[model samples]
Target: MPRRAGAPEVNAGSMADIAFLLLIFFLVTTTIETDAGLDRMLPPIEPPEEDVIIKQKNIFQVLINKNGQLLADDNIIGLKELRVKAMDFLDNNGDGTCTYCKGKKDAESSDNPTKAIISLKNDRETKYGTYITVQNEIVGAYNDLRNREAQRLYGQDFTDMEATYLNPETPSGVRDELKEKVKRIQDLFPQKFSEAETSTSN
Candidate 1:
């Protein structure tokens, strides 16, 4: 310990060692929390061809503003209604293509689940919670439809099929069967989520 002209200084001899020990304690004892959630593995991205044209009816627009307000299909709607709305749009069966689809054949809505593209646009200031909720709702719509189809085709849940496919210890024969089922289910309800860039003005 030492005292300067107008300041008293405590002993700093073992301060470094104490700090080091504290650091080691935190490193050893502290449990770091890792973010865990659903296994969301996005498919590979394929750049669109220049001449490709998307019909206006096939693109379902979902807009989120800075205030977390949702505008789906050009109509201001609540989060509770988003999933059902999306499901209807996805399974519209307008062209009578999807034999399993039970949705109303709304010609103004999407053509089919395969060609239905969910266009999501959010403002820069949109709340993270709003964004996540919207995402979950949209994804839930697809999952619900796929589950229905899986149940009809394989008498199993699509989520379980996906989990089994992802598991490494699954038997090869069963995995192969599940692979075909999964692929067929996915082809029936291919999730085409197109997230537009955030609005710069927001």
Candidate 2:
């Protein structure tokens, strides 16, 4: 009688090892996505301080309602126009001080970039994406002004100079020069935002 040979036993140890190696490879090489958030520093808490008076012309009010509607200075507006509006408000040179400003020097607009303030107020139920977009537009306007100033004075873009200044490998002496240049540009077009808890109209 011919006895049937038992089937060869397959080893699963190597298969498990391969799977573990694959998992490790993915863990080491896989890129993870993260949500971008606001990079703002909060002011120190002041105890019952007197209200500081900000000139009405210096304040550029922006509001967002629960329905993601944007209002700039109480007028309903689209996101596409927000950057231009912000730039105009910041560079108005109403006081005739910002010689580099290209604005129309509207008497109702901001006195100077140093005094320009964007008063951002949003309803509690406003979409986070809408708020971020608005913030970006405002910051972009400032960056544009700074870049133009840097280009005119230093023959380079302020944003690029700033990126180099922030790099870890930059030399201290070079960083110092960049710092002065950045300060000059910033002095011309400073970025200021006020996130006050003011009521917004729907």
Candidate 3:
């Protein structure tokens, strides 16, 4: 009788460890993306006030459809042109009141920055990206004007002021000074914008 040789068995003693290491490696390598929502400051609650009537000429109406089509002041405009149109509408001193304004002085345009209001409306099915783009264009229009004014007055850009004086690292005294400057700029280019309810139509 001859003794038969047996096959070598697989050593699985470290298999559990290997599997755990693989699981950890996958967990470390996997990246999850997060949605960056609109970076806007929420308005504080206030007591009900009387409805102040705003003139139609002062309101710069902007409409967006689900297809991302922009209707600026009842005229179809591309996204790239929205900023210029908004800037013109805001900076236009139709009444020759704003000395800072350098607009075309159209009688039908805004009388002053304070009176210029942007009325933004979108369709219910409008894409979030499109809405954000439109909002950015409007905001950029304001920023461009503010930055130019800041440069003219303070010899610095508005964004530079924010980065230097508004950051957490700024000193308390310096922050107060910056606040005054920012308030001045706000007075010059007040953001009197309003967002209306989504329209039912496309």
Candidate 4:
């Protein structure tokens, strides 16, 4: 018998079943993940009861241009000096309540830790990386001050104490105590950050 030259037929009877099995397997084994975003607490939305006037000397201005260049108090500054400059401004304590502060006490600087404020202004076109880095440096300044105060008063690091409070299994009483300790440290180096809108064209 001579075989006719024609396209060979394939047995596709199980093709649908195989594809369905594959879909079911993938659906069962694959795990979908949700996005994990930057973990930060936002400020309260309520407006202040009264407007308070702050001295220009007590306000430390930090400007980040669209080019990522930094200006500290109108003076062009490098990233390396930002932390130190912020620390200096915060710890000046010219009002003389910060016994543990080691600042130079310049009259033109902050009058006290309570009075010190950092005003951050950034152009709309600023790079996200630059903005985050600058924010980290400013927060690092506050953390350094808190850590020093925690060590001086409680003989423990601020992070360790924070962990004790943040743990879910911690007893409510113990957490309350830790909260008070954390509050004390915060009182010593209050973080007063104000964000300002600037012209994006710059």
Candidate 5:
């Protein structure tokens, strides 16, 4: 007897469906990451009771125009001189307090060391780099004051002193105190360093 011929069968109808289901699954399950933003300290909403308003007199106003020109108390100054003037102002409180030493007044009506307020006003179009430079200078002044205070509290050349016997934990308290003092100084000035927009366009 002769063998009967059989028909070859092929199944191609479900290939597209499998691919579509896989694509949908991947699309539904995948997660995309978002970028984190810059970190900064923001003010609180509610005003606290017994807010002691310290009258700010030693105001050093720094202005930067769109042209990158720097002004201290409305007087034009170069970058080098800006640092010098800022250091001077920080060192000497207009109230006769030596900012560097932070000395207190004696029984007599004498001068006590006080901190000054730095009011920075920049044009609306002022470059961010210029603003950062001014900010760095102010921070540097505070760091210098901190170092001086540390030297006075501890012995001279404290950096070179060994930590063999001294309690390292005690310095943490000192650092906290210094940080509070710096906060006070920073608070003396308005937290909003930039001023309102000027009428003239940059």
Candidate 6:
């Protein structure tokens, strides 16, 4: 027998089916990663049953000028005094109900210090950095208050301070307290207002 013309020689098989199956498998099994969002606590929409409204006070106002000058009430103060003032305010007004610093109300007095609101007014031209610094100072004040409360609650002998000074294990209770303080500040400034002195100057 001689060679046949155009003889078909086959060895393996079709890969089209395998490729199609693989495409289907990938389409069925592949997962895309999504970004995780920031964690935050949102306020409730409904009003509380008691409806005890706290009045805004001059003692609680901290104003920032366009020049980044800070004023506590009408008096110009440095960041150091700001923390001191905040602590004093919280110490005076704090009710034991506060998670941060539980200040006892004098037997004769009705006003609660912890319930006192800190009103922050920033000029329109104030840098975000200045605002953030003020916020950090405010948070620092709350942290100080929380630490004081911890000392009062657990006594000076507590050893957790060393651990707290380290990473991650520090009680979030202080941070939670700071968040509440920030929430109160946010409530006070529902709408941004120019510092009274700044408004008058312009």
Q: Assess each prediction's global lDDT (C-alpha) against the native.
A: 0.91, 0.88, 0.91, 0.90, 0.57, 0.59
Q: For candidate 6, lDDT tens digit of each residue in 58-175?
A: 1368888888899886789997789887766655533344344344543322134435556678888888888778877875665665555446655531224433443465568865
Model 2 TM-score is 0.81
Model 6, C-alpha of 32: deviation from truth (Å)? 20
Residue 146 alpha-carbon offset, candidate 2, angstroms: 1.0
Tens-digit per-residue lDDT, 1-202, candidate 1: 7766776778899999999999999999999898777545665598756766789999999999999999998899999999999999999999888888998999988888889999899999998988989999999999999999999998999989999998999999889988999999999999898888899552
Q: After superposition, which runs of candidate 3 have C-alpha atoms over 4 Å from their true positions?
A: 1-6, 25-36, 43-47
Q: Give a tens-digit lDDT track for model 4, residues 104-156.
A: 88988999889999989999999989998998899889989899889989999
Which ranges of candidate 6 are over 4 A from the true structure? Answer: 1-52, 93-110, 155-201
Kindly give the stretch of ten consecutive residues in candidate 1 with the minimal lDDT sum. 35-44
Q: Tell how far residue 97 is off in model 5, in angstroms.
A: 5.2
For model 2, the local distance difference test gives 0.88
User: Which runs of model 4 end up more than 4 angstroms from their true locations?
Assistant: 13-46, 171-173
TM-score of each predicted structure versus truth = 0.83, 0.81, 0.84, 0.85, 0.51, 0.48
Instruction: Give the poorly placed runs of model 5, Cα more than 4 Å off.
Output: 1-40, 47-56, 97-115, 155-202
Candidate 6 residue-wise lDDT at 117: 57
For candidate 2, the 10 contiguous residues with the lowest summed lDDT are 193-202
- Give the Cα error of residue 55 in candidate 4, in Å: 0.7
lDDT of 2 at 25: 100
Score residue 86 of candidate 1 by CA lDDT: 92
lDDT string for model 2 (1-202, tens) is 9998999999787998999999999999999999676789898887557887789989999988898888899899999999999999998999998788888889988998899999899998888888888888988988998998888998988889999998999999999988888888888877788897846555
Which pairs clash inside model 5?
97-112, 97-113, 98-113
